[model samples]
Target: MAGLLAAMTVSLTGTRVSAIALPWFVLTTTGSPAQTGVVAFAEMAPYVLVKALAGPLVDRVGPRRISWVGDVVSATAAGTVVLLHALDLLPLGALVTLVAVVGAARGPGDLAKEIMIPEAAERGRVPLERATGLMGVTERLAQTAGPAAGGAMVALLGPLAGLAISVTCFALGSMIVAWALPRGMGHSAPAQEAPEAGQKGQEAGQEGYWRRFGQGFTFLRGEPLLLSVVVMVGITNLLDAAFSQVLVFVWARESGHDAAVVGLNSSVAGATAVGGSLVAAAVAHRMRRRPVFFVAFLLAGPTRFLVLAVDAPVWAMVTVFAVGGFAAGFLNPILGAISYERVPRHLLGRVNALRDSLAWAGIPLGGLVGGAAVVAAGLTPVLLAGGAAYALTTSLTGLRPEWRQLDRPRRTGPSVVPAPRERAGTTDGGRAERSP
Candidate 1:
């Protein structure tokens, strides 16, 4: 558990740092928002697609191995970018391709880590909400530290230096996962019963790639609550991608600030977010999830964009982001708990991958749409529209009947169909566990 959390923190920090460096690099080099959006698309498109497909493989191959391989690939790709840039051989096309590779590798790598969380919590004898909240804290810490480091590095050393840091962090993450985690910690899912003698070959063939993939999709389709969450989150993720990948950078440039200011804003939010996460971790299990989820969304979304839209002072902007970040902190712990409770253990990898992929499907298009919208409409108008849309989406979605399930009692076993010969009362070690 210690090793997993540590690796997650290091790897995620690097990712957040690169998030800043890569976009700044593209924006500065091309001086085109459209080009910047294209670069973002190149990375996220492969990320979403590969993550969606890699679910069955992760379950079959074991998350430990996949995580190690994925981090190594990410490190190599990021290093190549730094090397090419240093040699003055890095073209826009090449940069896009390299980032795409990073994104593709990151997909399964991140999902593997996510799959390990419930097990880690069980091992540590922690409650589900607290464990997930701790994971949220780890992420918030990365968000806080990564942006501050990346901003300073970009301002003082340039974007390539930040990319170099990303390479180092990825390498370190791979090493931690390889050598530090306990034995049998992330092994493949338990095997099902043997096929009947007469139908052995046919059954074996049916258990191949597509069948495994379809099982996850079918399970997800049956869960109205999960599906509703996915759809709403998908829209918000698209808006967030646009806000982070394009609008924020553009705002910084227009306001005559450097990457340092961007870092400061994010870091402040992240720092405050850590406190929120900690509080959530300690008490979220005792509270009703529905109200907390909606309230958090209300405070976290819309306000940030609306503040920027009004051309508020830097102090005001900082305040809004800080408050919003604090509210945002409660979100993941609740969501993670619900997901882990609802999905069967055997389907963790595939089902989680599909859920995440569906929610993030809009991310690839976010930058594209935001850039084009800004080009056609202008920043202020786009910001206003984004805020309004965020408010409406989050608010209207809460009224649906499916959302009442947010506070459902924890299940003793999988909510969906169990595997052949699996017992009804048995769970991960006969104890109910959650994830983040």
Candidate 2:
């Protein structure tokens, strides 16, 4: 667990830093908001596409192996960008290509690491809620530290230096996973064949990749609760992408604070999130899932955009984001616990991949849409519209029937009744009696 957390921290921190550096670099270099959106789209489009497809492979090959390979690939891709830029050989086309490669590698890598958490938590004998809360802590802390570091580096040494540091982090993360953990840690036994259905020719052969994919989709189809969660998460993620990738960037430029203010705001939000996750980890199980989740979304979503929509001081912006971030921290632990409890362990990889991919499918489009929207409608209007949309979506979704599942206890069935001894023909003395 330590090794996994450490590796995740390092890898995610670097990624977050790069997330800041990449856009700032684009905004500064190209000076076209549309191109900033284009680069963001180029990277994440492949991320969603590859992640949707990599689940079967992650399950078959084992997550640990895949995780290490993904980190190595990310490191290589990041390093290539650094080297090419240093050598003056990187054009916009080449840069986009490399970023896309990094994104593709990260999709499987991040998913593989996520798949390891349940196993890790089980081995540690920690409650799934607490374990996932701790996971949230790690992520929040990384988000806290990464942007601050990235901003500092970009401010001092330029964007290339931040990219260089990102490569180093990825390399170190790969090494930690490769060398620090025991072998076969996250590997699973071969997947069992699915039961034959009545359909002609479908049951005659080993299941193909598409068949396995179908199995996951079929499983989700039966789960209305999970489906509702997925849709809600997808819409929120889209709004979040718009805010983070485009709206925030444009606002920073307009506000004339740029990287420093962006980093400061992001860091504060992340730092507060760490505290929130800690509180959640300690008390989440004792709390009701529904109201807590709904209220958190209400507090976290839309408020940031709405605050940023008007002219406000930097402190006001920070305060709003901090409130949002703190509320946001409690969310994933609940969601993760629910997901881990509901899904079969063997299908974790495929099901998680499918769910996450569908949820994240809107992200690439977010940057594209935000950029185009800004070009068409301008920044403040876009921010206003986004906030209103977030509020409406979250509010409307709370009224859903399926959303009630979040409030239910983890065990859905009635308590088991004790069998009568006479019915079993057994004595209370624990001896079997002869039947007449």
Best-fitting candidate, scored by lDDT: 1
Window of ten residues with lowest summed lDDT in model 1: 426-435
Report clash pairs, candidate 1.
none
Cα deviation at 109, candidate 1, in Å, is: 0.2
Tens-digit per-residue lDDT, 141-166, candidate 2: 87778877898899999887888889
- Once fitted onto the true fold, the runs of candidate 2 whose alpha carbons sit more than 4 angstroms away are 23-37, 189-206, 249-263, 309-314, 371-382, 409-436
Q: How accurate is candidate 1 locally (lDDT)?
A: 0.80
- C-alpha RMSD between model 2 and the true structure: 10.7
- Per-residue CA lDDT of candidate 1, range 1-436, in tens? 7899899988988898898798888888789977987897888788879989998888777788899999999999999999998899999889989999999999899888887888889899989889888888888888778877887899999888888899999999999998998868877654322223336534433467787788778777777777777888888878887997788888888777776777667777778889888999999999998999889888887998998888788899899989988888888888788778877765778888888888877766788899999999999999999999999998999998878777874463532234333222111000011111
Error of 1 at 342 (Å): 0.6
- In candidate 2, position 320 carries an lDDT of 89
TM-score, per-candidate, Cα-based: 0.85, 0.84
